[model samples]
Target: MSNAATLAGGFPDLSKLPVARQAHWMRWFTAAAIVAVLLAIGRAFANGQIEWSYVSRFLTAPVILQGIVNTMVMAVLAMALGIFLGIVVAIMRLSPNPVLKSVALGYTWLFRGTPLILQLLLWFNIALVFPTIGIPGLWSARAVDIMTPFLSALLGLGINQGAYTSEVMRAGMLSVDAGQYEAAKAIGMGRLRALRRIILPQAMRVVIPPLGNEFIGMVKATSLASVIQYPELLHSAENIYYANSRVIELLIVAGLWYLLVVSILTPLQMLLERRFARGFSQTAR
Candidate 1:
C-alpha cells in the first residue's frame, strides 16, 4: 500500500508547471483586455452627442425592411448565376484544348484584375460601347437607354463573381486523385461523364466551405449596387441618414443587420461543411 502511495506522490502535478500556468494566465489577460476595449468603445458611442432618436427612427422604417428583401434577392440571384458560370469556367480551365484554356485564363485574369466597383460602373454604362445590342440588320436600338440600374448591377456582380468562383472550383477539382478519373474511364465512362459523375461529386465536397464564404462575400459586395441607386441595404440606410443627418447611427444599424445576416449564414455553411465531410471520412474508412 505504501508503494502505491510513493508512486503517486512521485508523479509531477500539472499545476506545478510554471510555463503552463503562465500560459493560462496570459489567455485570461488577453480576453480581459479585449473585453475592456469593447466596453470602452460601446460606452463612448452611447454617450456621444448624436441623438438616439435618429437611430430609433431609422431602425423602425419600412424602407429598411424592403432594402433587406432586395439585398437577399440580389444575393440569391447573383450566386445562382455565379455558380453556374463557375462550373463552365472550371471545365474550360481544365480542358485539353488550348483555345478553351486560354479563354478561361483570360476571363479570370480580366475580371480578377479589375476592382468589382469598376466592373459595376462599366456594366451600368455599357451602352456607351455598343450603343445598340441587337443585330445591325434586324433590331438595332440603343441598349444603354433601355438597361436599368438594377439589371446592370446584377450582371456585373454575377459575372465578376463567376470569374473568382471558377478559380476556386478549379482548385477543388485538381485536389481529387487522378486514380479516380482513370477508374471512371476504365468502366467505360465518357470524359465528360466521368468528370460530371465521379470527379465533380468529390470536388464539391472540397469546395462547399469556401463556396459558403463566397456567398457571404457576395452579400457584402451587393452593397456596391447602391452607388448606382439600386436601393440595396446600404443605399437604403444612406437614404435615411441623408434625411435625418444621423450618419453614425444609421451606419451602426446597417452594420448590425449585416452582422445578423452573416451570423445566420455562417451556421448553415457549417452544416453543409459537416455533411460534405462525412463522405470523405466514410471513403477513408
Candidate 2:
C-alpha cells in the first residue's frame, strides 16, 4: 500500500512502509561491519603484548619531563620566529616595491619547494659546506660549533614555517576589506599605522584558525628535531627504548605525553579563535 493511502486510512495503519532511500540498508550494514572491525582492534590493544606498566613508570620520569620541556620550548620559539619573519615577508609581498615583492616570493619558493627533513640535515651539516659562519670581515665561529643541534633545528624548522606562515598571513590580510584600507588612509593614517590599528584587527579573525592549526602541528613537528640529536620528547623516548628494549612501551609513553600536550593546546587555540572571531561577528552584525 502507498504511504499516502495508509496515512489517509487512519484505521489500523500499523503496516511497514517501503524504504524511500533503498541504499540506506547497505550503509547500515557497512557501518556495522566497521564497528565490528574496530572492536577487534580494541581487543588486540587490550592483549598482553603492550606493556602498560612501563608506560606508567617512565611517563613522569625526570628525563621524559625534560624532553617534554625541550619540545615545548622548540615549538614556541620556532613558531615565534616564524610569525616574526612571516609578517615581514607578507608585508614585503604586499608592498609597492617590486624588489621587496620579488625577494619575498623567492624566499618562500626556495624554502617551501624543498623537503623539511633535508633542510634540517643541511643546517646540521652546514660545516661541511661552510667551515666558518659569520660576517666576512669580522671574526667567525666554526659552523659545527655555532650551529648546534638546537640552533640548526630551529633555523631549519622555523624558517620553513615562515614560508608557509607568510602565505597564511598574506591570505588573511587580503581577506580584509579594501574599503577599510581606504578608510584608514582617508584619516591620514600611514600604511603601517593603518595595518597595525585597523586592517590587522579585522584580518586576525580570518588568520586565527589556520595559525592555531599550524601551532598544534608545530608541537608534534618538534619531534623532527630529534634527527639533529636535539633531545625533544621523542628522542628521549628513543634513548630509553634503546637501553632497555621496551620499544612499544616507551613509544606508548611518548604518545600519551604528546596527546597530553596537544590536549592542553587545543583549548587555548579554541579560546584564541573565539576571541578573534568575536569582534568580526559584532562588526558583521
Candidate 3:
C-alpha cells in the first residue's frame, strides 16, 4: 500500500477535524434522537383515543384554581419555614459546641432518613399519641382534631424539608473559603455578624439554585399531603375526577398545571441565579 493509504488506515479519519466539529456531530445525533422520540409521542396523541374535552373542562374548573392557590400556599409556607429552620440547624451544626452539633446532626439524620410520606402520616396521627397539648389549666381538645390534617401536613412537610434544607445550607457554608471567615473576624465582626453579613450573603448565592429546585420539589411533594386529605392540587384533581369519572383527563390537567407552574418558576430561578452569579464575576475580576 502507498504511504498515504497506510497513514489513512492507521489514523482512522477524524484526526483532521477540530474538537468543536466533533462536538457538533455529537449534538446533532442527540437532537435527532430527541426529535424522533417526540415525534413518536405526538403520533400516539394524534390517534384520537384521548378525550380532549375532559382536559379542557378540568382546566377551566374553579376547583382547579383553588387547588393551584392551595398548592402554592403550602409550598411557600413550607419553604419559608424550612429555610428558617435550615438556617438555625446549619448554624448549630457548624457551632463549636459538641452538644449543639450532635443535636443538629441527629435531627438532620432522623428526618432525612425517614420517608416523607411516613412523616406526614405520623403528623396526621400525632394527636393520637398525645390526646391534648395545652397549658395545664387551659382548655384542651382532642389532639387529632386540634392538629388538623392540614396543620399536620404543614408541620410534617416543613420540618422534614428543614432537615434537607439544613444540609444544603451547610454545603453552601462549606463552599465559602476559611479566609473569608478570618477576614470577617479581622474586621471586628462578631461571630453572628460575620455569619449574617459576610457568610450568608455569599453562601446564599451558592444556595439559591438548589433552593429553587427544592421549592419545585416541594410543589410536587405537597401533593403527598393529599393522601391525608389536605385538598391540595392533586387531591383536588382526584376529587373532581372521582365525581366526573374523568381520571385520565383530570390527571392531564393537573400535570399541565404543574408544568406551567414549573415553567414560570424556572425563568425566575434562572434570573435569581444570574443575579447572584454577578458577585462571583466581580470577585474573579
Task: Tell me, by lDDT, which candidate is best.
Answer: 2
Clashes of 3: 0
Off by over 4 Å in 2: 1-23, 282-285
Query: In order, what lDDT does every prediction score?
Result: 0.88, 0.91, 0.90
Task: Please provide, for model 3 over 131-203, each residue's C-alpha lDDT reduced to its tens digit, 9 standing for 90 to 100.
Answer: 8877788776778667886788899899999999999999999999999999998989998999999899999
Q: Estimated TM-score per prediction?
A: 0.86, 0.89, 0.85
Cα RMSD for predicted model 3: 5.2
Clashing pairs in 2: none
Best by TM-score: 2
Ranking by TM-score: 2, 1, 3
Q: What lDDT does candidate 3 reach at residue 136?
A: 81
lDDT of 1 by residue, 52-90 (tens): 777777775899888988999999999988998999999
lDDT of 1 at 236: 96
lDDT of 2: 0.91
Cα-based RMSD of the predictions, in order? Answer: 4.6, 4.9, 5.2
